[model samples]
Target: MKHPVTPDGRYFAVRCRLWRMVNPDLDEAERSKLTKRLMVARRAVRDAKAARDPEAEAVAHRAVDVAKRALGERGPVWWKDGSPDLNRRIAKNTPYADWYAQVTRSRHGGS
Candidate 1:
């Protein structure tokens, strides 16, 4: 269960944080619950790292992933209609590029 120490995990953690800021869909109660779970999982990650326990770290990582997924940061899309994932890249390299650009432009009034 020892997950590799990759920068990807940290990146995901940061993504979870940033996404949470913009995600207003969750009501107060649900948001509170998920926030608590995220805090506990994050603490576990820190503790496991301090103890140098890779297996424990991996388990904690899973917890973190679960928490983030529940917060709609790292898992299946909440919407059912297969809408573009705004959380992903906006580059022309991806299929969502045009849609993403439109959404971004609309949000920013970029014409």
Candidate 2:
């Protein structure tokens, strides 16, 4: 849970890639509910893959997508600032590149 977040807080870095943060505007209960749905859908995807059921996997993937979108992690940008969505982009390739470099240098103890 201790991932580096972009300065604007719009995304978090994981494995050096950016993933959009969930909508902070969502009420606590709504966000929790959507998060639960996402967990369930992700589990379904795992099950489908283990069972070698391609059709079921596809369905589960769609469920995951829907849940993510509802949580504002996908689809339309949640922030109204007109900034481009950087979901899934490598941090080093984004405007966050300099910040990311600084963070890595600090964490790894470099000048």
Q: Which one is best on TM-score?
A: 2
Write the residue-wise lDDT of candidate 1 on 3-95 in tens digits: 111121211112112122213477889978998999999999999999999999999999988888887776766655665553444234444
Pairs that clash in candidate 1: none
- The local distance difference test score of each candidate is 0.59, 0.94
Give RMSD to native, each candidate. 9.9, 0.9
For model 1, the superposed segments whose C-alpha errors exceed 4 Å read 1-23, 86-111
lDDT of 2 by residue, 23-96 (tens): 99999999999999999999999999999999999999999999999999999999998999999999999999
TM-score of each: 0.57, 0.95
